[model samples]
Target: MDAGALAAALAAARRRTLSLFDALAAAGYDDPARLPRLSIVNPPLWELGHAAWFAEWFVLREATGSSPGEAGGASLLAQGDALFDSGRVAHAARWTLGLQPEVIKSYCGAVLKAILARLSHAPDDDAALYPYRLALAHEDMHGEALLYTLQTLGAAAPVEEDVADWPAAAGEIAFAGGAFQRGGDQSRGFVFDNEKTAALLTVAPLTIDAGLVSNAAYLRFVQDGGYDDPGHWSGAGRHWLAQQGRQAPRYWRRAGDDWTGIRFGRQVALDPAAPVRHVTLHEAEAWCRWAGRRLPREEEWEFAAHSGHPGFAWGQLWEWTASPFLPYPGFTPDRYREYSAPWFGSRQTLRGASFATAPRLRSPRYRNFFTPERDDIYAGFRSCAL
Candidate 1:
């Protein structure tokens, strides 16, 4: 990338980060009393500041040897990578820390302003350019997480009013398995550290779905009593269903055959054409079984996605993958060491970006992970042909 293009990239990234914050503020950032307590959705005010701090630390401080600005920068910005990172910290204690929202906002503005000023003068430097790109992507991911958090809290919905939306999953990609390398090529401008290393793996010729599962399809599972049938569910899935007495997808309420869902603070008719959102892997698995289908393994999912389908519009929705989230062959931790390495073992990977996902945030190689039982997330699933 030339100096002009690099500058444009930085400008665009800053603009996007600001826009995401605008959306969050529009959604709500009033009294802390108004928000839910102990939810993984919103890290406390301090955490938000810390997240911004990280952007500054990696992109500016480490990349360019710059110091964080005044304001709330000193209070929330921690030295090194110890604090503010979810991968390193215990999830539950995030809320216990007292962080004022106003201070957090101030810190965000401070770091943002400082970075913008520095970028205005810094000569064309790829070392500076790369970290800035990474930080922007990191912030974009957090912005999506913030939207998911809102969905969990029943606070708001993240819908892009303009672009045409994704249709439900209709079919699969027929792949003739060969020596397929399964990670990202850093040669493509910028990417997350996790997707950096890739290895060759022989994959079988399999047919994978074109899009994610839809509400109409999930409804069939519900109508057939798929949730009630123990045969369709796995041992853990059945146990989870029994514990919650789950009869329908989370966020859905049924009245007779008619159904309404709480979306974006209001109830709306379920759009059958749109892919079903907020479903767990267990639920997705059961639905697949009932339909005489199966979930695609991670390799299969990536193989299908690598072709770059026009059907995909980043930030529209997250597509669940059958594969467990793990490290690539030569996984090495970058400066943001704990980001992907810590959660590699058990978390299941989800592909695609949701409507809440920012445009530049994700790519085919990006792997998003969560527990199999988490339905509150803005995630959905696709299937493979048996």
Candidate 2:
């Protein structure tokens, strides 16, 4: 991207970051006593500080800073490593960081200003802009996570959903699949290392949903006692089901004869026509079993997406694919070495983007992954005919 584009993106991303942070603050999440103590989340104050610190560390520090703000160079903020270094801080420790909300916000504002200042004169080249994209992508990931955190905490968030006038979801689109590139090409401007060095994979002919499975479609499974019948679930899924016995989607609750789902803390009636969100992979797979269908493989999903199926809709929620998150052949980590190398094999691959996903982060090739049992995130699935 050009310097102007990078600067604009940084500014917009900062606005998003602050908007999310402000929402959480208004909900009292910024207070240490009121902050959530979940393993899947970090304290809001600490989270924002780390995001800003990351930008400064990657973009402003001396090129040879081995240990963050150590022998390499001094940080823009005093005790930066002691306060916000995620590499050294454990999950539980984030809550005890004792950083005040205003201090963190000030730090965030300062770091963004510094980044924009540097970007104005920076060379408009990929190599020079790598750090800027890296920081932006990292913050974008946090922004999406913050949305889920808001949902998890039942905090009201202002979200604009673009699901209206979506493509028709009534039928299936068949593809006569063949050998195809299964991941991101290294030649792209910016791509996660997990998608690097696109590899060839064999995709069998299959028919997939024209759009994601809808709330009404999934509701039928629930009404048919799909959860109680363990026969539809895989062994691992059954184990997960045993631990957290649930009758419906995680965010759903029965509303008299119909159903209601919590959207950013608002108890809104479930949109039967809208694609179901927050269904775990297990829930999706069980729904597929009840319907005599199967989850689409990641490769097949990608192929259909690239096939120019005008009705093959997405970007409503992250769609679960029957694929594990693993390194591709010749995969190499980018500058942020810890990004993709750490989480492999343990999580499932999700294609497409969620409603909370930033426009810059939404791409067909972008891979989103999470543990299968996690249904707090805005996610759903489409299926293939068995």
Candidate 3:
């Protein structure tokens, strides 16, 4: 990309970073004293601080001094690392923490101001450039996580003033598989270290749904007793389904004979016509099997995603893929060792974006992962013919 282009993209990204935090502040962190069960969505205060601190750590610290605020900000981030870092704690503990909301918000505000000041100097300096890119992208991801967290916590739907109409569903496009490029091409501007390289993989002929699996389609599975059939689930998935007594999608509530789902903090009629959100890999796979279809593999998912419209609604919800979340050939961890290495082989990968995904954060090569048993994520899947 040209210098002028880089400057423009970075400027656009910076604006998005601020907007993301503003949205978080509006999400209203629940009163800690009156909190509910533990979950991955922490109070908005904690989220705000983490977002700012991540930017500060990567951008400001490297640009000015390694020490956060001349005294090392690690203390502020220490106790909460296991709680908020995606790589550490279980997703369910976010709601159970005892953090001081006011302090977190103030600290986050301070860090944001500092980082902005540092950005004014050298917007494209490599040290400033790379980490700034990482920080913005990182915040973009957390923005999506924060959205899912809101749904998990039953917080109010994000107050989107000009809520763009959901894209007219892109009818599924047909892809005849052959040799295809998988993963990121570094020539593009900033991508996560995890998505930095490309690999060649051959794909078999298959047909993927024109669009993501719809809630209406998933409801058919529910109506058909998809959740109760062991034949429909993997062994571990079946075990987990039984353990959780899951009878429907994670947030759905049965009222009399109808189904309602929580959206943006309000319970509404489950839109059967809309794509299903918040499903697990097990549920996705089971649904596919019951329908005589199979989940698309990771390569197929990427091929379809990139093949589709460039700016599709990918950031709306994490789309499930048939592939496990493992490193590409010869994958190397950049400075952020904690980003992707630890979770390798342990997590199944998801592609596409969700409602909470930051506009700046996604690409064809982005990889999202969760354990097979995890059902609380902002995830759903698409299917392909055998």
Candidate 4:
């Protein structure tokens, strides 16, 4: 993106950051002393400051030859590196950091002001604007995480735009696949390090569902004893099922005959037309097994998304792929060393966007990932014929 587009996107992302922080504060996450310590979540005050610090680190510091290694400049926040550098700070340690909400809020404003000031003068070239783009994407990513955190915490949630891309999983689409480009191009600009390794891969012709599996369909699996049967589950699925002790999707509850899902903090009837969300890869796998189908390999998913199938739909929720989160052949770490390298082989790749995802971040090439056991994310799946 050019300077103007980057500036506008950055500003919009910062506004979203502040709004999520406000919602967190209103829900008492600003003081997390009473909250249970979950390995999956972050402290609200730390996340607020860390988001700002990352932008400053990327746009204001690294862009100026101050890498994370070399001594560059002092942070606007006193002891900021000690406070906000995620690599330096451990997750459990964040709770004991003794940060003040008012102070972190001030730091957030200051960092954005500096970030905009820097972006105003940067050259419009892709090389020059890469850091700004990274910062924008990073904050946008965190904004989605914060929304899900609110949902996990049962706090107030953001007002989302309608994400109904289609009425149902409009049957299946057959793709006679051959060579497919599996990753992003540098020319496209702002490609993530993980997605930058381009490869023309040959994939078998596959048939995949035109739309995501709906809540109604998944409920049928639950009612049919899919979870209890264990025969439909993989070993990992069984382990996760036993660990979670779950019979339905993470947020689901049944009242008499009707199934309701808890979204954000409110419980509402499950929408038959809407994609099933907050489901783990294990659950998705079990459902696929029950239906005599399989999760689409990421290649098939990429192919199908680009095939221009009029009935195909996505972006209502993140869709799981059968592929594991492995690096492409020529993969290398980007400036942010920990972003993709650390979790390789351990996480599952999710595609598409969710209602919580920012519109600017929505792209078929964007690879979302998480541990297979995580049902806290807004995720679902569509199946492919075995």
Candidate 3 residue lDDT tens string, 239-274? 888888898988788889788887656777777667
Give lDDT for model 2: 0.82
lDDT string for model 4 (1-386, tens) is: 78988889998998888888788888888886955689988987888889898888877777343245544577888988898888889888988999998898888888888888888888879888888999899999998888878889998765652233345566888888878787898775789988978888787888889888988889899989998999999999998888889999889988898988786787777788878889999999999999999999887888788667787788888999999999988898887878999999999999988878899888888899999999888898999999
lDDT of 2 at 194: 90
Clashes of 1: 9
- Whole-model lDDT values for every prediction: 0.68, 0.82, 0.66, 0.85
Best by lDDT: 4
Better of 1 and 2 by TM-score: 2
lDDT of 4: 0.85
Alpha-carbon lDDT of model 1: 0.68
| lDDT at 162, model 1 | 22
lDDT by residue (230-301, candidate 1, tens digit) is 999999899899898988888888867787777755677778888887888999999988999998887777
What pairs collide in candidate 1? 172-208, 172-209, 173-208, 315-354, 315-355, 316-354, 316-355, 317-353, 317-354
What TM-score should be assigned to candidate 4? 0.96
Runs in model 4 with CA error above 4 Å? Answer: 63-68, 160-166
**Candidate 2 lDDT tens digits, 184-263:** 76674777889878878788899999999988888889999999998999998899999997888888888789889877
Candidate 2 residue 124 C-alpha distance from true site, Å: 1.5
